[model samples]
Target: MFGIEINNIQTDKLFDVDRALENLPFLLEGVPYTLLLAVTGMLIGLVLGFFLALARGSERRWLRWPARFYISFMRGTPILVYLFVLYFGLPIAGIKLTATAAAVIGFGTNSAAYIAEINRASLNSVSSGQWESARALGFTYWQTIRRIITPQSTRIAIPPLGNVFLDLLKATSLAAMISVPEILNKAQIAAGRTVDSMTMYITAALIYWPLTMLFSALQDYLEKRYNRYL
Candidate 1:
């Protein structure tokens, strides 16, 4: 009886896995949405992050203080909480967004805080002498940043920025919580129909793993190409 029961369990597990594999196409259909979320969010974050970094680095107290507060608030809060606020809390104040839009905004805003710090640190890592030299060469501060500092800082920032991209990619799974129909959402729907949650979720994990590996490879290529100057 014990041997028979064990064999039955093994058969059930195999059946579940087979069902998951069969439903892979349905799950894969969500990949574009997930990719869209990550890419759009990262782009928005990059733009906002640049300005935030500038504000944080500004000499003016008014500009610096608000930027500092925004960064601190974003970094200190949990991302899911931020999402909840965007999706749920905003509705009460007469603002409404579709699930996809909210997810993009939430992820972008949260990512901006980290990216701002990354940019600021990378800019600072360029030697003080570089800034002094640019000034002595008759370049204004903004011109110096635009012409000299930014080019060098971008190379230094690439690796960490890649890390942020991967992180943002993974975080898009949270969009499922708001009914954005991302991979996890589709997987959950399949699991509900098939009653094989384990296999479905494992499939989701497998999908995410390869996507992450792809990003990592791209990161490596960029790092090598950029650092060739060294």
Candidate 2:
């Protein structure tokens, strides 16, 4: 008992495991909405990106120039700005979208610009001979695209598209700004109540990581399956 003060000097841990565990269920409740936004956005990106790819690659200036402008604009702008414009600015134009809808549309269309480039590159990766052979077999242009080109390009696009989806999943956290009840949003609410922002935000990060891993595993499986086609 000679001048010992060990417990007094022992510091508080930065991460409060107990608090994180307590908030686990609340954070989990936000997962469905997060996934919903990511998946819906991805679907939009795929559809719009395909058309954009076709347009961007077209020989016609009318089609190609407009596509180029769109891709350049989206790629150049910050997605957070885009989200704000859609969610906040649109009300002035009498187009008020729900937070979820705004987040989905913003993420989707913004992602499409990048996806279009991926699609274009994937399509180009298919040899010109594939097209020739398709035509030689009396295949219509659409038939050749549908029967031969799509399959090969799809296999090539899977990896990049997976990256896109993964990014979309993580970026959904930004939806909190617009008041979407995504994981980060939930974390913010918990932080306000608990006054332990670090633990709650860390808990949100932990939740997002698993969601990322789950999708990443799915992406890996798809890549392997598509690899079999080669």
Candidate 3:
């Protein structure tokens, strides 16, 4: 009888469907912040990563070494630590940043490291002969890169880029540690209020599922569109 009571108590805490339903709309409020981080960071990563790739592949040692060091440092570090330094450490130096700003910067710069490597590989995959042909036709360095290189390399880079975006999407959850008020943060709020951690987290997971699926389908659509030229 005592064991049965214990089991019943545990079951009550496990999953409260009513609590999850009540929190669903509130959880949905966090989706915009989550997307803001992911999309903005991805845009930042693409731009910075592109330049980093160029620098990494440059003939000049000055450009190459700095790019190499940045990528290595970012890749070697955990993004959580990076976010801490941005959001917490900066204020010590009289350069305070908001949690949202720090999270965006942290994700952007860290993801850029991986994106740079992907960009480098994609750029390298293009035939050297193509560069030669572009030059032979009097194409300037910038011209060749813009007209010939970008299009082809972009098509090659799309798949890995999509993976990076997906990873970034999930990683945004870590922002909760810094009080970014993202999905996990909202879930935590609801959990604290309801005393139903399981239900709140399950609802958060449910929100993440549809988001990931939507983006995955979007990735597929992009791949197909780019491959259309083939």
Candidate 4:
């Protein structure tokens, strides 16, 4: 050993509960922006993901290929890198987006790729027999999907969709990189002021834990409710 002594090392305080508690108000103020980013991004993802799922399922080579390529590219890229590119790259291409706009777009676009796969899996889980049955009943292909496949697939999709929602919520923290002022950004500011990095980050975790727990509880309830008949 190189003369380094563990016994003589000093560790910073891990928790200053009172200081963390005092910073709660300032930190919580960012919660609305965080929630807004998550909610709005999810809504965008849901709409685009549904179409992407359908396109991937389409018989046409053109539609399916584009959807496949989109999913592949988005899945291959990290969300933070995607955000940085969209935020910084677009301006150079003669398009500009505000930090909030870029955050939502980046999160939604990346989320759509995963959501598309989730929806596609749910759609495929429905029995093929039902598609045949609908055809025998003289339903058009679109009609069969709309009336028979979509409803059941929606129930199947709810649980996984909830996980995606929670992930998007956590991902909102990355928005701070673009100056969106979400929760982690506030915590960083507090840490800088107090010079207590450990305590401030622990406070952020405490804040996120309950929110995630509540989302998990809601996801369970919906999954059970949707599957009650089975």
Candidate 5:
């Protein structure tokens, strides 16, 4: 028999697993609000984006120009700047919303600009004859868009829209600045009080990591489902 001596090496509590576990509940408690903001904002943006996309694709100069300008302005600005303007600046003009509400609106509006472009490109990918075919079948323009164009465009648009939702979810962390008390805010409070920055952040990352993975899986599933229709 060969004999060997082994000695144990002790590690510091700098990355305390117990501390992370203790802080996780508090940090994760705010995840519901974070999901709410992301889902509601993305839904609002999706609806607004579709209308804007159609308007942008219109032949009329009046309609098309305004849509172009809106896309240009929203895409040109940073989301954090948009949040500041909506949450703080609008109060000066006698219009005000709660920090959470304002964050949702700001994020949604900014997202719509990007969503609009993606939707428009998807819409364009379909042949113009598809529209003419729908019209010849006695379908109204709205009906045609709702029933035909939308279904096809959805296949093209889902991937990018999923990207937008992921972007929105991450951006909700910015709401911490306005005291919306989302995931990051809760984690910050935990870090401040515990003086355990590394532990608290690791806990928050663990909390959010699952949510990101869930969305990613859902996106892949949806893309596959839609791709079959294509």
Candidate 6:
């Protein structure tokens, strides 16, 4: 094995910092795939989640029962367990999907359960009187929801939804378990080759930390904007 020249290494440079900086490009390379998974999962979950939230709030027993059941099932199960089943068991049932696709579907479905509950709670937080007033003004149920409920619920839900997005970003790391070459996956490869576990992980954190901070700042800005109306 070729020995590293310790004397050639700059005494002024911290080994960890220097190694982490050198591995920056490898970590940065995983950014796109991480964002891709997070965005895809969040977007798909948003639509399904809103519908499930609406269903959870429905007066109709038919809609309510199924929505409630779905939420209960998903919320009761761990996301990793859910993904394992989907990734491993589903193919046995003829539902074949690639690892990346499975990760997207799995995360989206799990997040939808939580998102539905968050929106439902936000919907409940809106005053019943608001709905009554809308109905008195000859608004249909849909019109009342569209005009009054949704706007208020959206304002209330933003912080929680943003928090969910942040969670989704972190959760994308799990994609590596299923062979998705996300940030952690690439970091692992680099670490294996370089035998520098500390440096590789540090590099990954450098990447993840800034991305988390960026979303956190956006969440704060939106929360403040909504708070102004309050």
Number of backbone collisions per candidate, in order? 0, 0, 0, 0, 0, 0
Off by over 4 Å in 1: 1-15
Residue 139, candidate 2: C-alpha displacement in angstroms: 1.6
Compared to the true structure, candidate 3 yields what TM-score?
A: 0.94
lDDT: the better of candidates 3 and 5:
3
The lowest-lDDT stretch of 10 consecutive residues in candidate 2 is 4-13
**Better model by TM-score: candidate 2 vs candidate 5:** 2
Count residue pairs with overlapping backbones in model 2.
0
lDDT of 3: 0.95
lDDT of 2 by residue, 1-230 (tens): 67855564523555799999998999888999899989999999999999999999999999999999999999999998999999999999999999999999999999999999999999999999999999899999889888999899998999999999999999999999999999999999999999988889989998888889999999999999999867
TM-score of each: 0.92, 0.94, 0.94, 0.93, 0.91, 0.89
Which candidate number maximizes TM-score? 3
lDDT of 3 by residue, 67-141 (tens): 999999999999999999999999999999999999999999999999999999999999999999999999999
Best lDDT goes to which candidate? 3
| RMSD list, candidates in order | 4.2, 5.6, 3.7, 2.5, 7.2, 5.9
Cα lDDT of model 2 overall? 0.93
Descending-lDDT candidate ranking: 3, 2, 1, 4, 5, 6
- For model 4, the local distance difference test gives 0.91
Ranking by TM-score: 3, 2, 4, 1, 5, 6
For 153-194, candidate 1 gives per-residue lDDT tens digits of 999999999999999999899999898998999999998998
Identify the runs in model 4 with alpha carbons over 4 angstroms from their true place.
1-12
Off by over 4 Å in 3: 1-13
Whole-model Cα lDDT of every candidate shown, in order: 0.92, 0.93, 0.95, 0.91, 0.89, 0.88
The local lDDT score (0 to 100) that residue 134 gets in candidate 6 is 96
